[model samples]
Target: MSLLDEVKNELAAITDDSSLAKQAQVSTMLRFGGGIQLVKNVPVVFAKLTNRSSAAWLKSSIMEIWGYDVELRKASSTLATGETMEYDLVAVTREGKRLALQCGLLDQRSHEITGIAPAHIQGNIAQVKAAWRGAFLAKGRLSDPGKSSMMEIVCPSVDSVNDLIMAARRLGVTAKPHRVNSSVRVRITDPDVIERMLILMGAHTTAREWSGKRVEGETRGKANRLANFDDANMRRSAKAAVEASQKVRHAFEVLGEDIPENLRAAGQLRLDHGDASLEELGRLADPPITKDAIAGRIRRLLQLATKVEKQRAANAEKN
Candidate 1:
């Protein structure tokens, strides 16, 4: 099963606290997921869904809250893998139109109101949670926990998504909206927020499981980054050591046995350990000198080589 389905099923199993909360859920479901449509001069409220649990939950919420028994109709379609089911929970009678009108889904003449959320549930926290839960049931989708950590809800319009964004603020989470044709998608990319949302939507078990998986993934990513850091440091040290050894050899060619004894000893140490760090070179010194002392000696040696190269260049130009 998909992560979304797992969460939706978990949410479906939860019971609402009050009728107001149930109404709030129904309101968001109608506004965002599905809405009122005129069918042969009758206003019918429908929630077209691929998730069975979500469809069941929405239908039951409408029934439980306002005594509207939404009809469940199943449709089949063929795909590359196999046949799939699209569950459409529809309310076609006077009860259906009443439920739609009560939820502010329809205005008397059934012109099909769009992008408006009911005012009754906005102030209450439980109602807000129910509203979000219903919206998710209608159209929310979540990526697998360890893979992407994205959760999104498809909404009816820009104003419809904005209503959810307002609701999200009450839940202490942030959401962004994107438009796809006439519909909008309310998106949450933060893993922490997604887990929090799952908990608020009454999917506590899935929230905890998702949190654990996200933490594990982040830990693994950090470990890999640390290993890469170490590898880069080693490569940088090796390159520096190789360049230092080359410069020290060139200085010897210019100055011959005329070099200072201490500096020559430091240069020889660098030549012997061309892949070693300066601290390691210092440790290998005859008297166990400090890293700074070894680095200063190498710096002076390279300066001497540079001076000789400049002098040779000027001499050749003069010639």
Candidate 2:
């Protein structure tokens, strides 16, 4: 199963500590996952849940906590879902109105409450967490931690987009809103935030596994970078060695026996060990020296050769 399915299963299995929290969860789920309507002048609240467990949980929560009977039905697959049918939980009762009031979906006078509702359905942290859990169970999806660390949710409305952002903020994780066509999306890209949110939603085991996956990904990335860096360094060293051999040969042609004894020895060592590193070349010298000391002698030898070559060019021009 997908990581999202795991989280949803875990969320659907959660047990609420209070009826108020359950009510908040139910209200949020109904608002985001389905529609609240008046069918034949009677209040009807329904949710379309992708996960079977989530659908069962919503239906049972309404029945057991709110004392409302919900009919769970199989919904036809849409083209957008690629023929994956979902479950529908339809609850028709006056209690739907009460749940809407608590969630600020409707006012005391039975009017629709538009825009983002005031945060925290019951002004309690548990209510906020449960409400967020409900929204996630309804619409949230997470990418595999081994591939990418991101969570995205389709909000029912612009109001819900902000509601989700506020809810996430209350939990100390930042969620950004994005608009794609007519739908609003809440995106959480930070791996830390995704892990923390999963934990807050009561998916502790999934969160831990996700954390391990993230760390493994980072470690693998770092090792690849180090290996690439070493490859680049080796390429540079090989190029430098070839270039030094050419310059040392040029010195022998231009400055010949005129080269200083110490400098000539350095140039000869470079010519003999065409593929050796500066440290190895230093050790191969008759009088062993440091890499830096041998390198200095070679630099002087090349400079002397360049000076003579420049003078020879000037003499040829004059002649």
Pairing residues by index, what is the TM-score of model 1? 0.81
TM-score of 2: 0.81
Give me the candidate number with maximum lDDT.
Answer: 2
Model 2 alpha-carbon drift over 4 Å, by segment: 37-44, 66-104, 114-120, 146-149, 172-183
Error of 1 at 256 (Å): 3.4
- Cα lDDT, model 2, residue 206: 86
lDDT of each: 0.79, 0.81
Candidate 2's residue-wise lDDT over 1-319, tens digit each? Answer: 8767887888889885578778778777877787678878777777788888888888888778756667888776666747666565556466667767765678678787553345554368788888888888888888876566788888888878887888888888899998888888899888988888989878898888888887998899889999999999999998999999998998899986787899999999998888899999889988799999999999999989899999999999999
Clashing pairs in 1: none
